[model samples]
Target chain A: MFWRETYIVFRRQLRMALRNPAWVIIGLVQPILYLVLFGPLLEPIAGQLGAQNAYTLFVPGLLVQLGLFGALFAGFGLIAEWRAGVIEAERVTPASRTALLLGRILRDVLQLFVQGIVLIGLAFLFGLTGSILGMVFGLILTVLLGAACAAASNALALTTKSEDVMAPVLNSIALPVLLLSGILLPMTIGPQWLQVVSDFMPTKYIVNAIRELFTGDFFTITTMWGVIWTIVLFAAGLYVGTRTFRKENA
Target chain B: MIHARGLARTFAGRGRGKEKEEVKAVAGVDIDVEKGEIVGFLGPNGAGKTTTLRMLTTLLKPTAGTATVAGFDVATQSQEVRRSIGYVSQSGSTSPEARAGEEIMDHGMLYGISQKQAEARGRELFEQLDLDGLWTREPRAMSGGQRRRLDIAMGLVHDPTLVFLDEPTTGLDPQARANLWTHISDLRVRLGSTVFLTTHYLDEADALCDRILVIDHGSIVASDTPDALKRQISGDLVELVVTDAAQAGAAAELLARIADTGVDTDTTSVSARVRGAGHEIPGLIRALDAASIELESIEVRRPTLDDVFLTLTGRSLREDA
Candidate 1:
């Protein structure tokens, strides 16, 4: 019943998304803009970071950018749903409460996957020289980050309950996370104290791992930490998301 | 199909030190409804009407007491209760972006019905509810009445044995309200669905409900058929205006004999509630004429539901609306 309910909700959300896909296209603009505008700047510094090219380094960071910021704003949709009484209506149904969270997370992950691929394809056009196998592996890490971020965002939406509050809340969270995770530049280029401060940011591991995987470097401690952090993040996100859904109006 | 005893809910007062103070939203009320009955809940704002509906529908848990809806316990067997009932809330739960028919189908499917059956029933409901040719229209694009009908279609799609509508016709124009009333009555006639609805409109209850329950200040104040409740007001209101101020006392004295309640005199006008005013009024007018009292105007009004509401609660329904 849980799986069936999840699939039902997922299908509904997917259909709604497909009907008005303007948001999906609009969501990709920021990452593509960064890739097109910022990739040439990273070329001169690529060799300094010991990479074959800037695309390999910059593309992975853009994936993290798409995954984090794109899915972090998923909460705004939820607040709209709450205002529309969509969540409260579903709560009255016999549907599994946890299925509501998982179904939405899966949808977010799929969208992140699509946006990541588009970013990757555009990166290759510019001059990215990365392994096909490694690119697929890197994309997996991005969607995992997306699933976690989307789940966390939804939990926050329930607590805030108003778009006026949610927009500024996500803004405050996005800035610090974007800078510390080194989404645009490598944290290693910064001073040691800065790197130390960024060490506390869990997103840094995923970004570093994606950059390594793009260079066909796998089976390393960096890759393991990234994989572990992703699983932990996804699990934590699901836990908090499920708790909020169950706690809501029970 | 529904039975509840002392059903109640209490919320911790919102904000700061107020959290320690508990506010009773539903202060214990008993309710009962047999199958195929259309029951109306009438209450003023903040009167716990919605709170009681939430408790019965399993959208909210009662802080006290118990309820059985569709033969399942709302607290312990909520899933079974949910499967057996449909609920359309006050706001009418439809996303502005979703197609009306698809929203109904999705809602039905969420209750464990097959997609094909849901679609079939949704289409039939649309046709019956006069929502034809609007299958693909989004709620945001529809008129106020159309959106409300779409909401009703969503709730009825799965064909639950019992349905609850919270202020279903609110915010609608007079013509739209009249149209929805027919559809609401048809539910009990066509599908044998027991309806429990809350509304601010007295005429809606008189027209649609087999019985009405009046709730006030977190409790049930009165429950009876609409006609019976109207009868509870005792008499028609008779107001007499005298041509001269000095004649107000004479008019008041004459009205007092036929008045079931006390008569009121204010300068040139005198008023009172009199039983069987249609029969008693002619003699009183003659008595005034024989006493050489000249009358300015006289109005005798039949007791209405509003009069009953005023008598029971000392508050008019429209006061807080």
Candidate 2:
């Protein structure tokens, strides 16, 4: 019954998403620009990952980049929905609060996945190469990260209930996480202290794991840690999102 | 179908420095609503009408006391209470991206209605609310009235036994308000659905509500049928507006002789509660004229819910909103 209710909300969100083409168009412009403009600049750093082509080494970071940035702003849609009285309207229904959060979180994941695919397609155009299995794992990791970030973003959005507060706070946290996650560059090339700092960041392991997968190296500690961290982030995000939702209803 | 005893809500003040007072949004409100009855909750700004409605709808927990809606405790069996009621809040759902019919149908689906049943119910509601030809148009393209009707339809799609409308006609034009009132009245007549509504419009309450609950300062000041409440304020109200503002006091005193109840005065007008004020208007005019007060207008006004509120709280309902 809960999943049924979630599906109903998910379908509504899906219709809303389909009706608004601008979200996808706008969401795609940033990561595509990074791929187009920044991918070539990382060629010198390719040797650090023992890769011949820089695009393969850099594309994995961009996949997570798409998810991180995409999911970080997912709460904007929810904030708008709240302002429209959609969230308040749902409060009167028999639908479970968990379903409400799950429905929206799933939609955000789907949206981020679409954006991830577009980024990957652009990566292929930019000469990124990898095993089919690696690409599949890469997509799954992006989606997991997106789900976690989007869930956290939604929890904060509901907590603050104001976009003015949400934006600056998310930016402050997102930029630091982005830099430390090594989304734009390999953290290993930086100073030993910087690498140590990056180790504390969860997305850093996912990035390293994906980079290893891109090189067709499946049997590595980096890949295992990446999976563990991504799963942890996923579980943590779902827990917080669901708890905040139930709390709001209460 | 609805009963509340000492239902109250309080919000703690923000800040740790100094003693910050907590705000009591709804303070000890008690109400009883029978099945298939239409009850209107009338109150001034910050009078806790919405807070009471939220508590009844299980959206907000009362800080004190208890209530049962649809035979289920609002605090405990909230899910059963929710399943048995429909709510249309003041700030309605106007999704700019969704077509009107689809919005209602989707809302019904959320409550576990099948698509076919939801569509049928949506169409019926569309016909009932005069929302035809809006199935294909997004709310952004519709007028405020159309969107509000859609909001009502969304609430009704599940066919609940009771409905709560919190200031449903607010922000609507007069014609739209009238149209919505017709549909609301029809809800009780056609479906036997109990309606608990909150409105700022006194005439709307007088015309539709079987009983009106007047709340001021977090307490229910009065609750009765409109005519019963109005009759408590004595006879018809005589509103005398004179040209000479200075003579208002003297005019009120003169009218007070014939009036059975108290006389009220403003800058240039005197309103006296009198038995048979319509028949006594000639005497009132002569007495005011003898006092050298030039009459601008003399209106024999019947006792309204506003007068009942004014007599009870020394405040006008129109000014309260």
Each candidate's DockQ: 0.61, 0.66
lDDT, candidate 1, A15-92, per-residue tens: 889999999989989889998888888899888976779988889889998999989999888888888878878888
Candidate 2 lDDT over residue span B202-299, tens digit each: 77897799999999889999898877776678888788898889888888888889888788888998887788776888887777777778888888
By summed lDDT, the worst window of 10 consecutive residues in model 2 chain B runs over B300-309
Report the TM-score measured on chain A for model 2.
0.95
Candidate 1 is scored at a TM of: 0.89
lDDT tens digits by residue: candidate 2, A118-139: 7878788778888768877888
In candidate 2, stretches whose alpha carbon ends up further than 4 angstroms from where it belongs are A48-50, A248-250, B16-21, B234-307, B314-321
